[model samples]
Target: MRYHRLTPAAAVLAVLTLSATACSTKSGTGTDTAGSDGVKTGPGVTETTITLGALTDLTGPYASLGRSIVNAQQLYADQLNASGGVCGRTVRITVKDHGYDVQKAVTAFTETEPNVAALSQVVGSPVVSSLQQEIEAKHLLTLPMAWASSLLGNEYLQVIGSTYDIDMVNGVEFVVRKAKLKPGDKIGHVYFEGEFGENALAGAKYAAKQHRLSIVEQKIKPTDQDLTAQVTALKQAGVKAVLISAGPKQTAALVGTAAAQGFAVPVLSNSPGFAPQLLATPVAPAVEKQLHVVSPAPSFSSDIPAIQKLAKDYKAKYPKALLDSGVIGGWNAIAVLGEDLKAACKAKDLTRDGIAAAHRKQSGLSILGVSHDFSDRAKPSTYESFVHKPSKQAAGGLVNVEPAHAVPAARSYPLPKS
Candidate 1:
């Protein structure tokens, strides 16, 4: 759904209406109450239902990912509800399209904060950063879609898997091992200019230092689509391999432009840098040949039973939907929330504090065979990551080159101080 630019009055009115309809509750300071079941109830919890809010980007830079994420979450919630949801209450998701805008995200949060148990999904680093203070002030447990390392150390924010820095560290390690680079070798890193890119660059820098390699940097904005100049500069630098901390468009442009220019070298990227739809583009051959993405989730083509079931169920639900890692990400995030809710239910405390405490106690949470430990808020759930390369025949247009694992360097890399 396309969202046109709205006038201030219209935007406020729209958000109010959207929040009221989506929440189906009166707005006020969200508080908890005792339910008949002896469970502590909260603003988004009632006798029969529990609601979660999602601030996603459906008409912006990450729309492709946002759509799939929402679809998978809704699918998971529907299935859970059908099977009798946690603590005898049904699960509901109320989503707002922020279009990756900071103000829109803050507005959505303001309008919806009083009506949901927690935020199920908030896409983009900027959006997450913008809402951090509010989330902390309200003590709302939130799962962010982005993996910027800067989001770490927040008690209210649940970063799903390995952070951007760890992903880049693993990515650089993978590229180094694959390319057999020696000391003094140079690698080029093309990145964006914000939390995501800067954090990933830190990882790359750390990994390079560990391997005794030099880095050539090319920083760009998210709106910088065509990476011809970046590619050209990297190629001129005579780097042995290139790493990307940008989006799919920049990934495609870099790989395709490099191939066309005959700047043949391994290209590594963070997870969010690839999309299955790119397989249909003219850069398919180049992407398949050169691009490798480090992902927290397994590919849709993975043979894991749970993942296979998810792929089958997702296909059955949305026949025309493009298979991508976003679906798995969304499903995993909601599953994590489900775990927290179940714990809260078992403890007979369904308030925001209850949920947040429950999450801290959660450990060994598995999705796609990766164990997530929520005991540490200063670090990611895991340090391991799957390395994938594009393939036309793969269900998500990418297949794992190797099983997910954390390298020695990644294991020892320290997170940057906030």
Candidate 2:
């Protein structure tokens, strides 16, 4: 929790020049680190190597995501080590599979924490929830992939993008404001029963209340694949638009099932709901017509100079892999990690505490548009998001409808109970 202001020259590499505006920041500021070389100052760090950890799900329901996150983290580390790693120390990452289970995640964290400096990517919200206490107790500065708004105030927590709750709010705002929800109309929500689903529900509920629209809810188990009953009920309920908080398979299933059942309503889904592979499936046309996604950044095809450079690098390294949300997200997470790592190294504090300190000072330095409008580390979250309409013409089948921005009442939305 301690921080020191970086010198101007150091700030150029570590801190992006923030403009004239009020914003959220990492942590409090102080002076430069004054530690000698050859002394043990942080965990998983030594004169020659720095070890990192990742808790992932390689054989579980969300295995695709877990694989993508690890691949990207390793890609980043490989590139760095090849070019002479941070502070002249080579980087190494240890990956542990939790299979998306809470108990498994805890066990993996318990074993991996002792051998690593930080956890680069923790995949599931519920899993992160399970490890939250131990992470704080150990002060392991973790940059998690799951964007649950509920994890906000934790000492070592840093989200990759906006939370699921925020993304949900953005989706709702798009329907109510731009898509034009009407009076006497209702919005229906179907979600898996977990932190991801609950956070998304919280956002949908907030938006519906604020817009004076009637809302109905349905919760589902992750194992229950057939959504015929849920879709039928929503159709019977006469809901106008549906919000889904589930994965790619369920997303396609619900939309496909709804289409087959003649309930042709638009679906607005949470970020994780869609993947590039959906476009190649049998339900491609239905998906293009009925689905829309909320995301933290522009799609992988974004022409931004930084993304272009990254895409180029990825193509050179792994030619056969198709660029999906997971791939882009993996690269993005590590890009941010690489920046903070360099900053931590420059500050001469490569230990767990020093890394946390460096993250505390990250203000406005986005690693090539991966994150925008970031201000402070302590409040490492944003209420802004963008809506992408499913498009048959676009490569990923989703086109931007609204530029990423803040909802009018976003800040007023209440934080969920601890």
Candidate 3:
């Protein structure tokens, strides 16, 4: 859902029909059986291979990120399979594109659920929200690419990094310090109207209250790409800085319009709000000069040993693909899942519930130099985040501007339960 994408009514009907066909013809037996190692195997977990599902947006608003994420996981699976995959079984991913539509995402999930042991990637906040109940009911371990706080508290849906609220709280603190915003100073927040934006806004509001700053709120829809009017309003409000919890297109629009209107100010955004390719656009100048992003993972060009290796392998495999931050996010989620599967294997139980249990037992996990704590299902994997700014010469067009750490404000802010 990247919140949501607009689709023609006809396309929705067509996808629904296609989903029905997939449901009838593509459904796997999903039967449980005993493995040679005496492991209890379930659907998608066979004697020779374990299949995972990826419900991603390949041709929608978040298509660029979706493709990047999918490709990285594919590369990881390839390497894992080559090196003897989890529990001596090869890993396979069955991917389905939902085009970022809620109904289509539901349809895709229903079609794909029967054939997979776990969901390796569900790419949108709203899409994951739509599937949470079924994920829990089935005891299916799922990794959501989205970081919405609302998606937390679900044991089945293991969010990979800092939740939207935590990232935003840290992001707000970064901006406040960089922009020298004193108490009573105002900042504008432009966000989509959904779980993703609202959750990030929660962090912003909390931080604002804590710092004695004021917030100018502008709520928009995912389909609303042009943010000229919103930019005008923030400028008129005379805000010191702007925080964005929307998509890349909206980010470009807001920053570009702000530049065109001469409303120069620091603009900070949630991770998904920026894409590397935007640096090639007319807004590149403004994006580079004014926009900063808070990411849950390392940049593609990061010099961290694991990240450098991933970058090398990813570039070798996908020579034509843009170096994207989603690759890191994708790899992180899959690596964590792989660890859980390994734990399940050691326990001689590869059932869906077994994998879920193994996930709950994981703590102090590290990937790409970020430590994750999954011991608490009610909390995010980590509060640490990397601050990034546009860099034309950097891979993914971004470079880390600050070290990864949870700011004091974020550490003290209470996470919203809703």
Give candidate 3's whole-model lDDT: 0.84
Q: Evaluate model 1: give its lDDT.
A: 0.84
Candidate 1: misplaced stretches above 4 Å?
A: 1-29
What TM-score would every model get versus the actual structure? 0.93, 0.87, 0.92
Question: RMSD in angstroms, all models?
Answer: 4.3, 9.7, 4.7
TM-score of candidate 1 relative to the true fold: 0.93
Q: Per-residue lDDT of 138-180 in model 2, one digit per residue for the tens?
A: 7788877787777877668777677777787777878776457
Ranking by TM-score: 1, 3, 2
Q: Write the per-residue lDDT of candidate 1 for residues 18-74, one digit (tens) a residue.
A: 332233344443556888899997778888888899998877767767777888888
Q: What clash pairs does model 3 have?
A: none
Clash count for each candidate, listed in order shown: 0, 13, 0
Which stretches in model 2 have alpha-carbon errors above 4 Å? 1-40, 370-380, 391-397
TM-score of 3: 0.92
The per-residue C-alpha lDDT of model 1 at residue 233 equals: 90
| Alpha carbon lDDT at 9, candidate 1 | 35
